[model samples]
Target: MPPLRTAFDALARLRDARAFHPKGARVDGELTTLDAGPWPLPAGSAQVAARLSKGAGVPDGFRDVLGLAVRVPLETGPWDLTFSTIGSLTRILPFPARGWCDASYSSLAPYRVGGQLRWLLARAARDQPKVDASLRAARRLVRGGGFELVLSSATAIGVPQPIARLRLHTVCDDAGQPTFDPMLNHPPGVTLYPDWLTKARELAYAGSRAGRA
Candidate 1:
């Protein structure tokens, strides 16, 4: 759990360093869900895309950043993300179908199996140290499944300074009940690209650094 929290914090801090506008640029577009597409490789893997409304004036660099590649497991459902700009009247910008997001990076699951095994093993290990039963069950369960990455965002309202919240939910369809990526259980220590948290962290950090300098 602590490791996951640390990773989230690192990701958030990374985003903050990049500095993105919360209200984002003026982007008019429709939001819709999509299935994974081809040409990106691993053909048949699910994917989603957002098409901005014409003449919306999205930043080219931001768009390029957002267009970065991401990967998710096969069992998970389609990805959904929201976008908004700084000083925008709308509190929430649902990127339902339109991909107004400025920056993007691929979401990868490197420890799906190992993490699952460790979690399951922890439960039994608490009861007994040397047990073959737990090991057997862990092996069987972790052998066949994977995880998913769902992207979403929120606005950080109120004083102290207004900001937006960008969230990514990691899910696994092993038992049909989706478990949010354990990563989001707490406020990330750092922010990643295209994430609202990133922008806020940058502002806060800059102010602190300036005061010291």
Candidate 2:
């Protein structure tokens, strides 16, 4: 039998879509460091590119796992952070949401930051429209300041530290967006944990790229 990546690649080619988060919309944003303590992201502010998508390619009006992938320019390279709507900081499990405004998103995996493990999470505000899967309603967050970025420890203990405010500025054209791969396009400050899982995702992403071409 073929390996998992080969099978996934075949399916992606057959469908002509991503292996996961196939339906996504790109957005440009700015990251403002809230008067918070130090974190992995750059100091002060930085320009960001984001993609909001639905897992399983579910249609609108239906609850589906949501994904948030953001890229920030760094001195080392581009830093890509991928997140999924999750239940809680402790669980690190996927949670389906009705809309972009009401979802709680987390890394769904562990990361090492400055030699310590951490998880990135976000909670959306209600001002945005509900049941709009396209995330167009959430654009208000960029100007109004509603999206909150937080960081939690690997143990899932203690309160999550506030990182920064991530605001979606405008929708970006698909032709201009960069291919985000958290596995490879990461800055020095963030490192995916567990050697085995990292290798697995690396292979999966490589296969996904092949199928797309």
Candidate 3:
């Protein structure tokens, strides 16, 4: 188990420094279907709210980890699917930036796909761009009823394979706090990796939430 108190303390420091992504723009859409893919999600329409932001307060032109949070209505309850530009986690300080549109976002942890543990991956956008044009395009597609959110799986070696697509329908503002934690908000089929990094993140999120409260 992780030292929750220590993790919370670190999270408080990060918050105090304002070292994380602070500005997020929200959009409302619909999760139309989970196409023929690896994840075991049903194909149906569900309300969705998504938040897009650049991490570490980096300028739009610079390379930074783009953050995305997708909230979907599920039978169990409202599930928040959080993603970062990188497909995997790293211990190194100052995370590297992989282009947002072409970048692969993961649950930042692993999940059970095909009875084996794998990380959930999703393409941020279709094409690479320096600005937020891809996000604008996604918004347009959502309004036009043509946006599809595709998710994939990353292997132990960090290669991505197709999984499913969630069709976006409309756009609206998000109602919840901008911050997201995969350990607390993941869906039913998703699982976290059993490792120090995962535990640390769980603790950090708990601490951050406590600080906010």
Reference-based lDDT, each prediction: 0.24, 0.71, 0.59
User: What's the distance in Å from true for residue 81, model 1?
Assistant: 4.1
Evaluate residue 131 in candidate 2 and report its C-alpha lDDT on the 0 to 100 scale: 43
Q: Compose the digit string of candidate 2's lDDT tens values, residues 41-65.
A: 6788888888888888877677888
Candidate 2 positional error at 170, Å: 0.4
- Please say which candidate is ahead in lDDT: 2 or 3: 2
**lDDT of candidate 3 over 65-106, digit per residue (tens):** 766677766666666776777633541223435444555666
Error of 3 at 20 (Å): 2.9
- Candidate ranking under lDDT, highest first, comes to 2, 3, 1
In TM-score terms, which candidate is top? 2
| Residue lDDT tens for model 1, 26-64 | 111112223212111123323323211112223332222
* Top lDDT model: 2
Q: Could you estimate the TM-score for every candidate?
A: 0.18, 0.85, 0.70
Model 2 lDDT-worst window of ten: 146-155
Against the correct fold, how does model 3 do in TM-score?
Answer: 0.70
Error of 3 at 170 (Å): 5.4
